[model samples]
Target: MKSDMAQEEDEPSGAVLDQPQEISFRRALLDRISPLISSTYTLRPFPSKWQVIRHKLEQLRSYLAAAGDSPSDSQLMELLQSVTYTAAEAQALASRCADESYTGGKLLLRSNLDVVSAKLDFHLKRLEEFYAAGILTLARAIVVSRPPAGASREDMRFYVKDLVSRVKIGDSQLRLRALGALNEALLEDEKYARILSMEVANGVASLVTLLESESRDVQEEAARAVDSVARFDSHKAALVTAGAVAPLIRLLEKPGTSMEAKERAARALKKLTENSDNAWSVSAHGGVPTLLSICSEESGTSELVHAACGVLRSLSGVEEIKRYMVEKGAVVVFVKLAGAREEAAQVQGIELLLRVACDDEQSTAVREGVLRALVRVLDTGSPKAKEMALRAIENLCAASPSVAMLDHLVVSGFLDRALLLLRGGEVCVQEAVLKAVSRLGGMSEVVKKAMGDSGFIPELVRLLEVRSLQVREMAAETLAGMISVHKNRKRFVKEEENLNRLLRLLNPEEKSATKKFLVAALVILTDSTSVRRRIAASGYINHLEKLAETDVTDAKKVIKKLSSANRFRSLLTGIWNS
Candidate 1:
């Protein structure tokens, strides 16, 4: 075999080597450096310096050996050449340091040793740079395989790193395969996701770039991988920081994108934005309008629409983005979704509508379908859906402050649906319906009469004893609003049970704000002399007398009304007896 120096001279300088040639050159260089580091040097500084250089060279050798079949480019070839040259210099220095009788002084020999050590350190750092830069390995066109069953942690780590390397540098076909593998791995074990997250540059960033791939398959696979990784809260910030939002939004806004791709992209976004800090990226990239458009599409797949709505729901938690979505007609889109035949779509629509309902009134002039859709949702939606739907209706009523809207809702049968939910719905749903009923009750005497005639008064009284303090307060307020109508008042007093429930809630021991509304209702009930006598005769009158001393809302007024009626009744009785 030719000597190492002759082999080095035979190779052309600054030329890109084929894979075999590069491998041979690296092997030869490693062979030449090994004996130099292994041989002992007698001098003091030389021994320690060779030890440091030996450690660095050993690390480089292991890196190259393990990085099997990684294709070489000009930059890597140049780095290898520099390492080879530095190894030669180290050998020469080693030979001189071994000769104790040499005329070269200790200072000169030590300085040379220092120079050689520094050069080796620089080369090692460059090797690390190549690794971190994600160009250390350019995978062949062959597909990457997943780790074997029951693989060791280090083995699994190697498999993930190999796949990530392929994703970073492989062709379109290889990248798609690698992304699919990565998605599978991440889903199969969360440990793989944690590993990927640790690879900041070669990992999430490579996947984010694939989001804009010209091929839909590649883009979809990339999005699916991102979706899997994003499922882990620890991985979400990595994805967001890698700039995943803008390209995903592009997929949603892009016209020719497949429904599958859009759904994957939307799902990824939904997971990513679950962290509120990542929400601004969506708004910053015009994602609000794109998401709204997806929701508005009549032909969008249910999954696509649902995922888009989910992202919108997360974005709405950010106040600025919520306003932007409203500006882009998100309310109308969601309102239409609320009316969709699919219960899932209706639920999502109602949820998003609840977020933007206050701003929805601005467009209600053109939204003739909102009330009917909401009423439909209230009728057939799940309990949570019904709660959101009712709350949305209450928001609309409060926003517009219009009697015509309330009349239209009543005409569309809102009152009946609300009463049905109030009587039998879940506690959350009951609270929401009570809010809507309270808003409608305060609107006009006609609404109050309609509500009372629908038998809402008894239900409101029964709710006074519910476990939820908020529900009791809402019920009292609604009953108070309706009690101004004579028929509603009569409906309230017609059941002695109703008066007792109200008075029990108004007891001095009660600490809730519901007493204010109860006092107001009783003050109205004083309009009837018989009702007044019944209230004065109830055992809870002393509770009101104590409440009046504290000056609770309208508590003093209730006391004055009862006291005046009693004085008048006493005088009449005395006159008749005399």
Candidate 2:
């Protein structure tokens, strides 16, 4: 951090701080005025004003220590010179006031004292501004350098500290370079991110302030660094505490800001809002509308749209913000995003749609549009995308089971797509499909029968044998909904294996929570005499007897129904034998 002041003494006055000779001259001037202000001859005449001026001069002398080595801005050196000469003038005037042979009048002397005091006060304030801008600290800051390869933690710590300081006070080019290096260091490892965010003073704040830099390069680099730091969960709280949200939203809102900068800002915001408090911070800063606008812009790059929608998706977790997003036409944005060619954008949009679809019912066109996009996702998207799309469809139809919407779902082949997904999709996708089936199936008997006829019942029945208890429970729940339609009940009862599986699940030894829904499905079937006769004859009736004794959810009622059917069967057999 050595200063670069030159030895040349002949440079112009504008470049005086660069010349060691001028620094020495400024020092000598301060020294000569020091004794004049220190003496009682001056202080006794104007005690209060002299005290103030002397203190200001002392502060000015402190600046000389750094100014002697550092190449301060020209303005700073000029002010220093002005104050030093003013202090000398104040000393001469005080001397005139002190001496009885002085020719100047008393009022004139008092006025001179007032003028000098005002000048010192004004100079002190300007010096304070310089310090506040970190000019003095910048002067003393170590020279910026790249960290050595395989640097030790201590070495890295020093490097990161220097970078943060430079970012806080460096010139435009220096700040840009420092920010670029800082961004690289942060991304290279979380350790540097930790040091910058928690250990280095004002480190996060420095990055945040640069979000508003006049230089587009500086803004971009700062955003990159903030985005990197924000990716680590441990650093997010510090960023929010440092007020990163508002500037981030401003960057997104700023017109004609380069997409590169906006993308990084949006990404940092996405990470920040993962924490609920940070989401509220963004919402409080009016970030939701900004995010929605980004999502709505058709010309936005896929990555940009994906990142912006990602922010809104995170924000949707908050109930209050979720409603607010709905009011602001986030649904329209989400539906548009859901149709994007990019898989990531579609996933983000669908995820948010799943959260808020139930609250949005005014736009049937939007719902259908979202439904069509979801179907497209189911058809071509990756497994995760398919899962999110299924959930969104489930929520959309469940929220508003209008005949038209349900008809749209059916007419658009939602059931067919779901059936295919259930057959071959990943376990997660299948699970989401089961939920969708349960919701949509319960909405319409036509949908239920359509699902039953499409072999959904068979797939659900087979899912009962799968290992995930949740899947089995959802399967049973969906089947229970399907069987409420008389045709579905008959279709389910026609499979003796389905009945046997249900009977096997009823075993008290089976601890699956699916038993309740299985029991409910069986109760729906017991209305049929043949189905009851088949269940009574099954070997797994022992499980039913145990469940009946425990009165496990409609178990006794199932037994009573089976008992009545048994009596009828015996009478029929006896009559036939006679």
Q: Count the backbone clashes (under 3 Å) in each candidate.
A: 0, 0
Alpha-carbon runs more than 4 Å astray in model 2: 1-18, 25-78, 81-121, 124-171, 177-214, 224-260, 268-303, 311-333, 340-343, 504-508, 567-578
Alpha-carbon TM-score of each model against the true structure: 0.66, 0.65
Per-residue C-alpha lDDT of model 2 across residues 1-578, encoded as one tens digit per residue: 43433323233544535456445666687577556645633345667666556545544543443332555556666676677678778768766756733566667777887888788778767865775665444443335465766877655765676676556545787677777777777777788998788766567998899899888888899889889988899889999899999999999999967899999999999898887778888899999899899888877788788788778878888888888888898877877777677778878878877677666534787677767878888887878788888877887787888899898888898888888888887889889998888878777888888887788888888889898888889888998889899988878777778888888877788678888888888888889878877776788777877998887768888888888877877899999999
Which RMSD values do the candidates have, in order?
A: 8.1, 10.0
User: Model 2 compared with the native: what TM-score?
Assistant: 0.65
Alpha carbon lDDT of each predicted model: 0.77, 0.77
Predicted candidate 1 versus true structure: per-residue lDDT over 1-578, tens digit per residue: 99864555566754455778777877787678656646533445456666666555554554454345666566777778888888887777767766653457878877877787788778767766776675565434433357777877655665676676566555677677777777888889988998778732246788889889888899889888888888888888888878888999998888888888888899989988888888888888988888888889887899998898888899988777887787788767888888787879888887777667655434565333566777888877877778778777777677776777777777888888888888888988888888878776777777888998788987888888889999989888988899999887777788887887788777777588888888988888887888878877888888888998897757888788888988988899999999
| Candidate 2 backbone clash number | 0
Candidate 2 lowest-lDDT run of ten: 2-11
Local lDDT at 43 for model 2: 47
